[model samples]
Target chain A: MGVKSTASNNATIFCNSKRFFRKLKEQKYLYMMVIPGIIWMLIFNYIPMYGIIIAFKDYNIISSFFEAPWAGLKHFSDFFKDDWFPIIMKNTVGISLLKLVFGFPLPIIFALFLNEIRNSTFKRTVQTISYLPHFLSWVVLGGIMITWLSESGMINELLVNMGILDKPVAFLGEPKYFWWIATISDIWKGLGWNSIIYLAAISGVDVELYESAIVDGAGRFRRMWSITLPSISGTIAILFILAVSGLLNSNFDQILVLRNSLNASSSEVIDIFVYRMGIQSARFSYATAVGLFKSVIALMLLLLANWVTRKLTGKSLF
Target chain B: MRRKFLARRTKGEVVFDIVNTIIMIVICFMMLYPVWYTLVNSLNDGTDAMLGGIYWWPRVFSLDSYKAVFADSKIFRAFGVSFFRTIIGTVVHVFFTSMVAYGLSKRYLMGRKYFMAMGTVTLFFSGGLIPTFLLYRSLGLLDRFVVYIIPAMFNFYNLLIFQAFFREIPDALEESAKIDGANDFYIFFKIIIPLSKPVLATIALFTGVYHWNDYFAGVIFINNPDLQPIQTFLYRVIAETTSVHMLQNMPAGIRTTSVTSHTIRLATMIVTTAPVICVYPFLQKYFVKGMLLGSIKG
Candidate 1:
């Protein structure tokens, strides 16, 4: 009786597998369309993920990936003990936090103020001009900025002329100014473009909310504070969560272009450290370890941020 | 008449409007002035620009810097690389990402959840730069043009965007096509492709801008000067050169008589940024729409 039942179960399994294959064959085109993407992800993303094992191994150019001897936690420990580790972390967190604190809110304010503008032509023109900087590469902007912040450049000239400085000052040459420069420049590049999302949210707000508020004698400021703010709170929350997760990411391209020997103390963020160690110095294993550490921390931060936002505002990225 | 009456502003509101308008003007000036200053400097005689009081216009008007920039064969080659890469990369990315998005959008597709989970994992974590570089090296992608195209072909964010857009498309349209004996590929090519023009254009612009502006890939992957994109070329010219060193490495065949390194660098900056600035005005709405779509939970 047991043998007979097992045979029937095997027959049913075979029948189910045949039906699945038939369904798959019928929708073969869908499979064909998705296959390229799956293959790409495996080759580009998954392989790299697998290659991250080098962080645990004593990887070198001379040895094949599998042949590399295990180093366990040696590379990670070395990174923590590295002389530049503290400085790198400081700069990364400093610049990223500065941008978050100052750079994040300016866009929401910009969007709100932009929404207040009554004239369409003026509004469109302002928006067009504002977003122009975002499209330009940091290479171009950095080149322009290097000249503008030089001792003899426009910024120094303006400051000196306005009695803000006694003499020309080299803005980029000073390590003290690097964080501010990075943050401000990031804001300048992103302000209008960043505001686009907020503006979209504002446009979606019900017109009747404003009308009813006005009828209730609420001023524009009150309406904006109570109505528009709450309307787009979800967007703000999501973006803030994203910002929190990216706390370690200083703008690599911007920093790389702007950094010189004089500003190295303040400009050496984790991304730069990784680039220098891995690509420049060819300390691949150590760099991979450092990068892995950052990735793990970033993932944890993202999950934590998502959890907090969900708990506080009932909004989550997932 | 009632609407007009209701639109009347209070004294405080009037003051607020004035303040807001002034603020907007200042912001606009702040945004425009740097590029304007760069343009002025680029157009100025290089030696004269060193005197450093030229704020609004080129005091000694000359096109020598631009002339010098245009004269370089390397710059032209780099520009060609940038152009072709942006076009080809955008095309391949839009096609591949949208194809996958459409397939994934089908709720009944086999192993759909697993496929989505695979794509979703990429969003939060990546195998850091060194591993990626190593993987690319092993794949023989380093220093090759296709390195730009293949690795960038499937962005998960873009796939999500396309999936959201594709799902909004009426099932009836696709069902009708299927009833006519059309397969998924044929319907996607014939019907869906035509319908998805806005999203396609939006994604295309985004991917194009990214490719054009990216100097990191060129800096890390491609060592060959001939393969470097224009932005990378500009980065090299700007980052490596001081005024003193510029004289040594000034483009071999050009007369640097009226052009200094600073002015030439500004010219290079202008040239690199010109394509984006020129196209931005017309494409502004689409970019805003793209941002909005991206912000949505896809």
Candidate 2:
């Protein structure tokens, strides 16, 4: 009886292997199509994962990756104890929060206002004009901003001519004002582009609800407050959750382009700091440690936000 | 009496329309003022531009900036490199993205779930820049044009968009093609490609924009000045111009003002950004449709 049972088990295993190979053959074309994508991910995404070890090593180019001496948590400790840590963290969090407060709501408000326009031509024109800024690179936008906000630039000239101040305000140079200027400019660039999604969601709202609201003698404002907002609440909630996930990311490109020595104190975020330290200074280990810290926190925030959203609204990102 | 009531209501609506028009015009000006300022100042004489002379219009208008930019051989070379890179990179990106998206859209594909999980993992958690750079170095892609294209080939968001579009394609079509003895390649090229033009166009536009605008990858990977793309060259121009401004403030012998730097920088910006901006309106219809379709699946 024992011999028979052992033989049967072997036969079953053989059958399973055969079935797997047959299925593989049936789906060969599908596999072929996915080859380039898989190869790309393996080369670009997965291969880079191996370099995370440099975060724990005293990375040196001459010594090669495998020979680099291990530093354990020394890099992390150095970053934590660094003089600029508190200031960098404060600036990053503060600027991101300011963006969250102003930039996040502006698009929603714009979408709401746009949804009121009955004429499609006017709406389309507004959208096209508004979204143009988003496509412009930070390099281009930065040059334009610098030109417009310089001492003798348009804004300062208008202010001086109107007698708003005795002299041109140093908008970009003053550290205290840099954060606000950065946040506002960021909003201006993204406001229209960001509203595209919200507008799409708003357009998907059932027209029957609006028609019924009108029959009930509801005013435009009343209908918007009642039917429109609630209908798109899911979209808002999802976007809000997604936005919260990236609370740590104060756009590096914009900050990098706009930063000068005079305003570096207020403008420098973790990304810029990482680029400066890692790439510029060649302190790979310390930069990696900082980046790792940010990534871990970001991942935690995303998971927590997703969990909370799922629990409250039964909607999760995954 | 009915005509009079209609006329009164029309009058009221006209008044409301005028108010709306004024508000919209103000918004439009606010949107366009910076661009206008940059364009006007770029064409004006550099000194006049610096002295707050160009407001809504150019003062002492000249094509000297354009002349200066054209005179720089580096600009032309950079533009050529950029153009070539954009075409190749965009094509490779679109092809791979569409293929993987189509493959993943099929429910019967083996390990589809695992592959999808891997792709999504990349969206949130990257190994950061050091790891990525080290990987590129190890692969001998450092300072190579492939560095730009390879690293950017698999955009998860674009893949998702394509996947959503592919999923919408009727399964009957594929089945019928198979029954007619057409292979997967033939089906994909003949039927799927024809049906997928809208999404393909959208992805192409997006990928093209990314290639045109990106300077960071070139800055990080390409150390050779000869290989530098237009965006990077434009950045160098701006940085050099800023440094020149600083030099101008220095004491006696150190100060050497380059009068044309400002104009040159502005002209470069126009040239670099113009192509992308010009193509945008042509693609606007696809942009909205693509965005809407992508969002629905997400």
Best by TM-score: 1
Interface DockQ per candidate: 0.76, 0.52
Largest DockQ belongs to which candidate? 1
lDDT of 1 by residue, B1-298 (tens): 3375347778888898899999999999999999999999899998899889999989999999998898888988999999999999999999999999898889988999999999888988899899999988988999999989999989999989888888889999999989999999999999999999989989999999999999999999999999999999988877666333334555655655688877878888898899988998998877777777887853
Instruction: Candidate 1: list runs displaced more than 4 Å.
Output: A1-11, B5-7, B242-247, B253-255
Docking class of 1: medium
User: What are the models' TM-scores?
Assistant: 0.96, 0.92
Cα deviation at B7, candidate 1, in Å, is 4.2
- Tell me the lDDT of model 1 at A255: 91
Choose the strongest candidate by lDDT.
Answer: 1
Model 2 residue B212 CA deviation in Å: 0.5
Off by over 4 Å in 2: A1-11, A63-66, A310-314, B1-21, B239-259
